[model samples]
Target chain A: MESFNLFASLASAIVLEAAPFLLLGSFVGALFEVLVPDSFIERMIPKTVPGQLGFGLFAGMVLPTCECGVVPVVRKLLARGVPPATAITYLFAAPVINPVVLLSTYFAFQSDLTMVFWRCVLVGIPALVLGGVLGKGTAADILNLPKPVLRQMDDIRNENHGHDHGHECGCAACGETHDESSRIRAVLVHTGIEFLSMSKFLIFGACAAALFKTFTPSSVLDLMQGNNFISVGSMMLFAVLSSVCSEADAFVAAGFSMLPKAAMLSFVAIGPMVDLKLIPMFLSTFKRRVALALIVVPVVTIFYLCVLLAYLEGGV
Target chain B: MIMDRLHTILEGLTTALLGAFMYAFSISDSYWMLLSPKFQPLTATAGFLLFVTGAAMTTRKPPRNVRRWGALCAMLAFLALACWAVLGPESAFAPDPPKKHTPMSLELPEPGEGFEPRLTLNDKEYVRISTPELFALIEGTNKEYPREIAMRGMVARSPDLDKRGMIAVFRVNVFCCLADAVAPGFLVSVDDPDKYPQGSWVRVAGEVVESAESHANGEISLPGMLMSFVSLNHEIRGHDVRIIDPPDMPFTFEVRDKEPFAY
Candidate 1:
């Protein structure tokens, strides 16, 4: 396929696939806005080192919000007096450790319970450690989010007074200001808007993925065979560059069956926990130092573990 | 206030209408048309028309409750149709088949040994199979062939299989469609790994051997499948390769009562 045509096809497919996910995330994140009050979270967050780490890991399992999109909300929690450490933990853990990603992972990896269990353990460790460590600092001022963006915090807070017709479920940020009549308008408009906004990224990712799959020669992947430092390094780069969403990364990883198992495991571990597309959102929602620290620390730790496992296995 | 009230009614109408449409679509047989090029454009146009009409009705003063109800019903009908089309004959509550355990004796190279072949041999051909069924068959077919077992299937690479060779051949069986399909890969130790590229269907017959390795805990266990066994199982099933695609069913109840969402 011509580059242009490939791009177009991929763009459309990605958006369509990702639409439901993004909307679902948005709906659930908005509900978090309503159900869990800022003060409650602020009060509930742990104050000590181990407490912060434990809370961070547990939060990742329970929170269903997408990591990338959840950044803004997590940042909102931070601004609302929630601890920076807890907020940071939520940010990192939310993306990779959620129920949706877990379910998808279980299905994609041929229903391997062992793989699923290790995935959580391997990814969750750094999220807890770095999040708690990073929380100890006073770097919130470095984030530099605009005041107007910050005002969205209050927009959700005051929503209950503005619009009330019925359907007062108060379950979603969008649903909160809507009566029955307005609910249709909200769902339609929101769905349409969301579909348009996110379709581009989805399509871009899918098309590129499919094209890469069809065109990329086997030798390219073969080059990274074995557990040599270079091979592990190259595969890690591949995982990060693929930027496959956490939910879909396993299929792509599985597609590379010719590659070593340990390296493949590393790809599964690192890709979803951190990715290029999701980084900016993380930066937007958390302290820059904190985001940077969270991303770099977990990746480095997991990469080392992947190499160690391969080494111990005599080139798995 | 009037406009807000009107908008509210319209919003509810749209949600309720879309809900019903999604529900119906879940149960409808024409759901596959949603993926069809010819059908998608038509549906998109219809959706646009409804959206515009919806916009107009909401913009009007004191949005008529009747129109709102009509819109809600329409939206619901559309949603119902979408849902019906997407989910076909699959419900979560359906009773599962009884679990059966198979002893490793049937698959063992030696009748008394515990090793079992993951794929089943049918009419001297190896059929693609799941782990459980494969084991079950092994338990049932408790006799070692005097000769090597030969099976024919496609050669596709699978992560679950041992990834020692450059090209791994696998055979996949499609029960319904590619959506809910399973493929089991056989480990073939290729001398010239590059000669047989990925995605090639081949016939391979090999004596399976178990190799032991030490774990981090210092316990030794065999994890790798060695190709002590040998046979060139047919690489291709020439005439029967073509499988017909089933027509898309829109909204069949998913056997599991999970949230049924139309794709």
Candidate 2:
């Protein structure tokens, strides 16, 4: 019973911390669906892969969505014909590169810019590389959407191509609502749909994380601290199991001041990109192969980078 | 069509319930048990938005295609989790010490005009400080250290500290939530370590002295620390110890600008 209670507390904490961001992301996605036209996205994005990747890498600076909320927005962008590379880059990079997360990292590390610098480097490089590699695939190859969802995307594309419904038509998809009341209602409906669609995955992920955190002894991670390779791996594993929000994870990493800088760096860097909560979200959002690539690429890239860092520091 | 409408309605109800659960935590102080106080307003706003979204959803026309059984199960699962959130214990269970030893220290406030060290408790005064704060104060440049000081922490047994006839008293510092909690505390030379059992909350007024002089031997090898425990250098000699009820907010938070307590 006590274990269950602990699990409940931890799970609730994860959910409550994430729920607001999820709602915000859903609203942003809904607003994008209602207000932003597909042509606008196409016209705005650069045609070249490099340009698109650059745009995706830094887009989070403006939108500033965290990992929890970034998925929904990325889904909307992808469905609306945003370049795969750009959307994928934004999906992975936005959580760490955004102002909120960076600021938190700065504060957590007592204004040490070095940690912040490495974090961006580690996450940004992998995100850009993945964007370039993964973005080459077609929507059919990358997206694991349901039939209805696919049909809806087709309908939007057809609608965009068929006729230009100027602002007067009051169509819900075109940002031209008959009145302010209906526009709000439209946004609400879209948000409701998106939230419902994504939140189940969040709940499942939180449950898994909470169970792991409650039952696993902290000593397990401690025992591995002697070896640099094992320490970095252990911390990365801890990051995945903890599934802590990127905004607050810096403080958690800072708590392990005794650990090597590489180990702590791995904890913060890997957490936002991949974790227990993100696995289900990734599987649901992207194709099996794309999702697998997304997970494997980041984990492998980050592990090598952190180990290299340990070697540079003479800990290896 | 009926199944479609039912599915939409159930999703709406579950959404509303989740909103209500969050709103309850926000309005009541129980939110601090799960999240930092910084998130209270955000939680409240999210709850309101979710409730509105859900209420609006129930009034909408049923979709042409029914939601899949998988979606329905997901909604049910979300509902179950939300129910658990509402029904479960508010505070997290006490944290166990991490296996890896990290010598804890706090950033010391600059010694200037506004530095006041004395804390008054129950009409009596003692130089009150946290274990981390004590560590900082001793290690810092200031030569004069307070003779009698009060510190509060949960008492736990440590074999290294026990070998030197001492018990550990440490407060768990939560960075964000319970998942990232770390206990950073002091070893105190007490009359009877058994009298203050593990996890018992205590407020001890003691003199800060060199650990070497406080115990039989100056050298005590901690499990993970090789010559690292020697660097701890200081321990508390308990003059007066009292068992106390755990504070409503048992956990200490990382010191940000001004807000000390999560609530």
Give the candidate number with the greatest lDDT: 2
lDDT of 1 by residue, B17-110 (tens): 4433433432333323222222233334434433443453344334222223332443343343334323332211111111231221111132
lDDT of 2 by residue, B69-167 (tens): 554576566556545654544344443322232222233344353445455656656676665445445664444556567877777675665666778
Best by TM-score: 2
Model 1 / residue B185 / CA error / Å: 8.2
Return the number of clashes found in candidate 2. Answer: 0
Off by over 4 Å in 2: A46-50, A63-91, A94-119, A130-181, A234-296, A310-316, B64-90, B94-125, B135-148, B158-164, B213-233, B254-263
lDDT of 2 at A117: 91
**Interface CA root-mean-square deviation for model 1:** 13.6
Top-scoring candidate (DockQ): 2
| Full-model lDDT, candidate 1 | 0.44
**Candidate 1 per-residue C-alpha lDDT over A1-316 given as tens digits, one digit per residue, 9 for 90 to 100:** 2333322322232222333344444444434433444555556677776786667666756555554355555656655656666766676677667776776556445567666776776777776776666677543542446435555644665463343432122221232233335544444443432222332333334445545544554455445664446555765676777665565555445444445666667777877667776666557655677568757887888888777877775433
